[model samples]
Target chain A: MILSEREEEWMTAYQNGDEDALERIYTLLKQPIYSFIFRCTRDEQLSIDIVQDTFVKLQRYKHHYNPKHGKLKSYLFQTAYRLMITKLNRRKKWRSLLPFLAPLQQSEELPHSDRMTIREAVARLPDIQRAVVLLFYYHDMPQEEIAQILGIPIGTVKSRLHAAIKKLKKELEGGYNESGSL
Target chain B: MSQDPFKQDRHLRTKLDEYHVDVPDFPMKPSRWIRFINLLASPAKDPLDPLISTPSGLILLKIAPIIGTAVVTLIQILMFL
Candidate 1:
């Protein structure tokens, strides 16, 4: 994912404390970030919150963005990914401590549409694999960038994508049975 | 033998395109920003709140006398002087 020169300029300006540059960056990246999060969590509100938090984190940790390290988009995605994992872990712990208060978990019903099947299969993926798949396919990021965003080796990213796609194929083709085998 | 799943990548991409999850308009509501700022401005929780909230806090409370003895002796000597 080579960023355009204009995008890099905006990022640099934002890093230099240009609020307008920050706003532009937000406008450009918001939808894709939100969509990535929405697909992963399947929760609209939580996705929105995470998007906002990602930017706020960018603002708060402005110095952390170094072009020498990576592109701003990759940095933002990395921040959001970490935040999403933290939120999911916290939710899991809360659910375990207070089962009654946990949100109703989605049932493993056979999806009616191919799109729905894809969505369900994605939501069911282990967190790391799902992140890899979303960044790779939907975001059109190269495996190297995904590795940078995930802080994993490109080989690990490749393997995760392979495993995730394999699982999705199984789910979509086999359909759900009473036993809930994928 | 199972088919190569990568062959289905195109299909998955198409399905992903068809999947419509509405993205809300950005530069989120000002009220939300206000709330976020207020949260930032709000006083931080007491540092010892976590320690005191748990059994360790109770243990600290029990040992307060033993911990305070040195300070108490210093105060007594200062007062006598």
Candidate 2:
């Protein structure tokens, strides 16, 4: 299991209404959840908000987690993902109302770079593909579990991963040699 | 430089690893419910705050006049009593 035994115990205790256990679990998993949201959203304050929301969500949905089905880490990531997606969708609607603001938003979103770095390439990927790449490569999530977290089929996961990898390769080819990318 | 896609994949992983994120310190961070309540009472933090720009906010804005009238009516009733 990606989660250690002690962490799992904390999760169990937390579910049982042990408030003290929450600090331990939050200390352990906060970084992972925050980074995952940050990579996906590229928004600092929004990432922070989503991470806190994920914890609050854990308190609300504690009884809903099943150890047999998945680890607590995955559960937190799934909650964070849903929360981020919901906020992103809401932001999208607002952005749509003022289409002219897109360019201004983009300019502020990324700093000027002489070349496209791997980070920029990853950030430039479509939301769905970027998510698959981050979850698979960064988090080391298996396709099946990723499918569960993302609420997509295994086949879709595979295809999205394939597409994301291909796009990453093309974008990073300057640094990538024939042997492999570095 | 013989072709090994797995090697390329690993390289890509290595490149991806370059993007490191720094996690902010975990204090006893307050729950999001508290944040939302604060946001509603306070000025908008982010200009593009999702709460202020959503249908929920729009509904509230639409009914502000009604709420204001109801509050005034309730205050008048209390004063009369």
Pick by lDDT: which candidate is best?
2
lDDT of each: 0.74, 0.77
DockQ agreement of candidate 2 with the native complex:
0.14
Candidate with top DockQ is 2
Which DockQ-derived CAPRI band holds candidate 1? incorrect
The 10 consecutive residues of candidate 1 chain A with the worst lDDT sum are A107-116
| CAPRI category for model 2 | incorrect
For residues B20-65, what per-residue lDDT tens digits would candidate 2 score against the true structure?
9988764546666766664455322354355468998878776888
Write the residue-wise lDDT of candidate 1 on A1-182 in tens digits.
34545667898898777889988888888988998888888766667788988988888888777887777778889988888989878868966776545454343333455333666777778878988888977787878889988889988987898888777767666433322553
lDDT, candidate 2, at A141: 78
Clashes of 1: 0
Model 1, CA-based lDDT: 0.74
- lDDT (Cα, tens digit) per residue for candidate 2, span A1-182: 63566777888898888999999888888888898888887776677888888887788778988778777888889999999999878767756775433222332466545356777888878889988888877787778778999999988988888888888878777656533432
